[model samples]
Target chain A: MDTLEQDIKILIIEVLNLEDISGEDIASDMPLFGEGLGLDSIDALELGIAMKKTYGIELEAGDGRIREHFRNVLSLAALVRHQGKGSLTHTP
Target chain B: MISWDVPIVRWVQWPGIGAAELGFIEPLLRRRLSSLARGALHVANACAQGCPSATFVFASRHGELTRTVELLRSLAHDEELSPTLFSLSVLNAAAGIFSIARGDRAPATAIAAGVESFGYGLLEAHLRARKSPAKPLVYVYADAPAPDPIGPQSGDPQAVFALGLLIQGDASSRLHTAFRPGTMVGTPATLQANACLRALERGSADWTSDRHHWCWNLR
Candidate 1:
């Protein structure tokens, strides 16, 4: 679980070009958009691409909980783990 | 000859092609700017310090072609196009970013005119300024050579550079510029920044294209 959280943080930094930021800077439960990290909608879509490429997860628009799963690193880690059971789908 | 008196209030140009210090913008927003946009916004911000609201003319020969090419390559590979790159790949990306940064809603226009982008940009700025003589016009021209993917340019490679001009309605300003149709043979396209700088320093400068002659004289 800890490793998954750290991986997601690295992925965020790399994919978003978040210079001078590291996994240590991002708390697992902090919001990723409009508040804590202050990321915008474009960033959300970018992260969705990175996550899809890394974990083979496909986010569909019809899923209502997409926002919830993308709320923070903790939720993203959980989603990756849950989807790793071969349901390579996402709601992003 | 059609011309407008674009009296220069102040101007700034990049020392040369390099990183621009745009510390004024937030890191998040700043990170998104290409080097071209950074140099452009830096000089534009310098010339527009006191005047918060004005009409803007942003001209570029190859505006964000680097980003556009990358997006196209991604599409060719059947890869998901990066949303950020797709959004910022437009010709007016720099102008749009400038408006967003300043939160100034003044009308802005972006121009691209082959090798004569700088000259035509100034002409456009004059036309827009004519509509509202009371407001200052911020004219910014920025370009790097067309990226390699587009193929080599016919002329010498132009250095990555940006020039900003603050034009007011004062008629007594020493700078006088004019352009007219002319035929010139065997001259490489002149980068307007170098010509304008020479005109400012040595009292006059002239450049020619296949269709027009642009000259700046200081009186």
Candidate 2:
């Protein structure tokens, strides 16, 4: 669980071009959008795509809980962890 | 129209400006604006802050190369391109974003005319203004070199430049600018856009690019 959380943080930094930020800077439960990390919808979309490519996890746009799932590193880590047994959307 | 004159109202040039400095572009939409778009918007916002009726003219030699190059690479590798990058890669993406953000339905245009892009962009505004002489035009120009695999390896490759001019004809404070057809055949020592901007700066009243002759004077 800890390793998954750390990896997701690194992924977020890399995929979002947050050059000024480090993995230690983003708290696991802090909000990723609006206020906490100053991220926006486009970053969410880009992160969603990056998560799918990296973990083979398909986070559908239709998912009602999609916004909740992407709130922070913790939620995103749980998402990737449990999504391993779920169905995939894109082939990649 | 080579001898045409455009009265300039307010103008700004921001060289080496980046997206981080453009907080006026709202965090949500700002995230989507590419570096090129950000630079263009930087000048656009600076020149037309509260003027909701401002018509826009966005000019760029290479509009959004970083994202376009990435999308091309993804195609080469058969990788899935993200929807965000694909959407913002258009030539007039900045102008569109500005209009939507401002919720103003004024006319906006995007132009790319090779070596004569800036000169031609200015001409485009004059043509548009001729239709409605009372309407003011906000001309914005910005360009940063395309990256990697297909970018220039050296030699003054468009250094993240952006400029804006609030143009109005027959204004109290008017700077008359004229363009004459010059016989110079090859690329000038300076970039074409740089020639116009340098003229706006402390350079001189007369400037020459590869094939266009430009002159500006304040009346």
Candidate 3:
């Protein structure tokens, strides 16, 4: 996996509290919701917030392609790279 | 005086003062449990063993107050709050998590009655058991001192503990509980739980508060 993809995987694991799984366990292209990681709507919102905090990526709630951007680690990394900025506020 | 012969079928407590053993819960869901929920579920699970389903009465004087305080602090700082934290920062969080984990559809009630949480929780369980004499009733009380500002003046016991009791409406052995108006006195929920435990082990325990007087006697 590329550096950005690896980072996104780590971020997902940390933010979602996937204690039993590691980055190696989550396939870069696997679906993150419903089947692969079994994450739900709460995890989606949490992951979105974490992304905003870490990568300064502001996701519009009404964005039709939001699901596509959060589809998997690779897609999340692409979103971060597309935004190309770090957090502007305290990352607490 | 309203009283009933409430029988305690089983009892358990969590970790003396440390983390509770929650191997039954999947790490995915368990990761969201706060320490208070962890301990409450730990004892509740143990007491509910062998029973297919049971009514649950979960009580805490300061249920998730610590987490609620943290969330409020985050909001005050204009920081983006964690969705997970906000979700679990409720008095009924543990009871909800327990029902989901067990896949049991039995009704669960959460109570926070100031210093009388333990007493009123058992009373609530007794009332529920009387209504449905067939189903088992589990009364679980867990509390930890809340962080400064919100709970310090409440006189909560400094220790953290969870107590579970399996209540049966009719049994060979019985516990007699009574309540009446009395002078108010502040007592910590932990001490109230301990007093109930002592009553079960020995013979009786009683407390006096400005609003009420509560007593328990194993008969």
Q: Per candidate, chain B TM-score?
A: 0.91, 0.86, 0.91
| Model 3 segments more than 4 A misplaced | A86-92, B16-19, B151-155, B184-190
Model 1 pairs in collision: A58-A90, A59-A90
Which 10 consecutive positions of candidate 2 chain B have the poorest summed lDDT?
A: B150-159
lDDT of 2 at A20: 59
lDDT of 1 at B88: 94
Interface RMSD of 3: 1.0
The candidate 3 chain B region of ten consecutive residues with least summed lDDT is: B182-191
- Tens digits of per-residue lDDT, candidate 1, B1-219, equal 655567788788885455576777888988888888988999888888889788899998888898888988998999999999999988899889889888888768999888788888888988888888888889998887778678546432356688898887874565667888887866667676568768867888987877788888866
* DockQ of every candidate: 0.71, 0.31, 0.79
Better of 2 and 3 by TM-score: 3
B101: Cα error in model 3, Å: 1.0
All candidates' TM-scores?
0.91, 0.77, 0.90
Q: Model 2 chain B, TM?
A: 0.86
Better of 1 and 3 by DockQ: 3
Native-to-model Cα distance after best TM-score fit, residue A20 in candidate 1, in Å? 3.0
Error of 1 at A21 (Å): 2.1
